[model samples]
Target: MTSPSFNPYHEWLGIDPSISAPDHYQLIGVPRDEQNPETISRAADAAMSRVRQVRPGDKSQEWARVLDELREAKSCLTNQGR
Candidate 1:
């Protein structure tokens, strides 16, 4: 079963009445950390990647993130030049 932490989308749709959706998400219990920051970072990256992989998307939807990041970088560089 998916953990309660992953229920925002369903809850937002007014589906889970027995459990009141929190005004904000509460990440209780454990802190996410690793001896190597890259390890935890990679795990989060892979999990999000798997979610996207499971839901195949249109090209723009798929590439939107990388494109947006590049655009932001270009803007930052242009501002630095001025």
Candidate 2:
């Protein structure tokens, strides 16, 4: 049985259990309190780096969705209102 915290989407996105959530910041593994563009960029890059290693296989669609979410997260967080 899967753990209560085990989410296939989060697993596919390479998001650690401790940082997993529906929000953009959590999706990118960046703290929501952080507002610096450079810091967010670095964190997004690191998070994407981990996610990019996933071989799509049967989950290609899901993988693509997560990648899109990461991109959106980066865009949103880098914007002023974040």
Candidate 3:
């Protein structure tokens, strides 16, 4: 079992969401001290690359899951109103 705050999405992105953050930016690798679009973009790109490596077959379900998480993180990070 995992803690409620243990987001596998963070793991997939090689980030730890539990890290101290002034806000939610750390969930996707952005620094709490500063919001950088470039940094968020890089994080999203890395997640995308990781999910893309999952070829179709036995891991199709995992691929779908990771892809969904990647999209979610990207949407939150890129949406200025968020």
CA lDDT of each candidate?
A: 0.34, 0.74, 0.59
Residue lDDT tens for model 3, 1-82: 3345644445455555664222335444566554566778787777678757655465466557667666676677677666
Which candidate has the highest lDDT of all? 2
Alpha-carbon RMSD to native, per candidate: 11.5, 3.9, 5.5
- For 4-48, candidate 2 gives per-residue lDDT tens digits of 664645576555656645788777767778989999988888777
- lDDT for model 2 comes to 0.74
Model 3 lDDT, full chain set = 0.59
**Residues 1-82, model 1: lDDT tens digits:** 3344544323322324544432211111113322343443443344344334443234334344433433343333334425
Ranking by lDDT: 2, 3, 1
Candidate 3 deviant stretches above 4 angstroms: 1-34
TM-score of 3: 0.54
List of clashing residue pairs for candidate 3: none
By summed lDDT, the worst window of 10 consecutive residues in model 2 runs over: 1-10
TM-score for candidate 2, residues paired by index: 0.75
After TM-score superposition, the amount by which residue 33's alpha carbon in candidate 2 deviates from its true location, in angstroms, is 0.9
**By the lDDT metric, which is better: model 1 or model 3?**
3
Candidate order by TM-score, highest to lowest?
Answer: 2, 3, 1
